[model samples]
Target: MDTNHNKSEKSFKIPGDWKEQSKQLKEKFSTLTDHDLKFEAGKEKEMLERIGNRLRKNREEVLNIIKEINLS
Candidate 1:
């Protein structure tokens, strides 16, 4: 069993209130549209990919941004 692949897939986690964090992200990143930030259940990876593409960032960068925003 390839546990590493599964772990990476499920690695990212929502740190705090996603709504509030997403709002902050939108404020910081004007290019992100509603569609980019729109999160669906069990679709976290997709949402991150959208945000990463819009921001020209990688998955880790997106995760870090979300974490930093939630901390602030």
Candidate 2:
């Protein structure tokens, strides 16, 4: 089994309600700037990388943060 596969399996796409989720995330993590949260459809990995670098988090952690505020 490839551990890399496990990492990819844990990755997630931004939800359809991402605008709302983005608002919540900004409110929750004040350090996150607009640039850090910039997202484009089919480019979630890059967006997550930006967010992770700014927030000092890994991809999975960023996904978890989004999940926590994903309710719409």
Tens digits of lDDT, candidate 2, 12-64: 67776777778888999999888888877777788888999989998789887
Top lDDT hit:
1
Q: Candidate 2 has which clashing residue pairs, if any?
A: none
Task: Assess candidate 1 and give its lDDT.
Answer: 0.87
Error of 2 at 16 (Å): 3.2
- Count the clashes in each prediction: 0, 0
Candidate 1 clash pair list = none
**Cα error of candidate 1 at position 39, Å:** 0.9
- Candidate 1 lDDT tens digits, 1-72: 666664645546677688888889999999999999998887899999999999999888988888789788
The RMSD of every model to the true structure, in order and in angstroms, is 2.9, 3.2
Q: What TM-score would each prediction reach against the true structure?
A: 0.83, 0.77
Superposed on all Cα atoms, model 1 deviates from the true structure by an RMSD in Å of 2.9
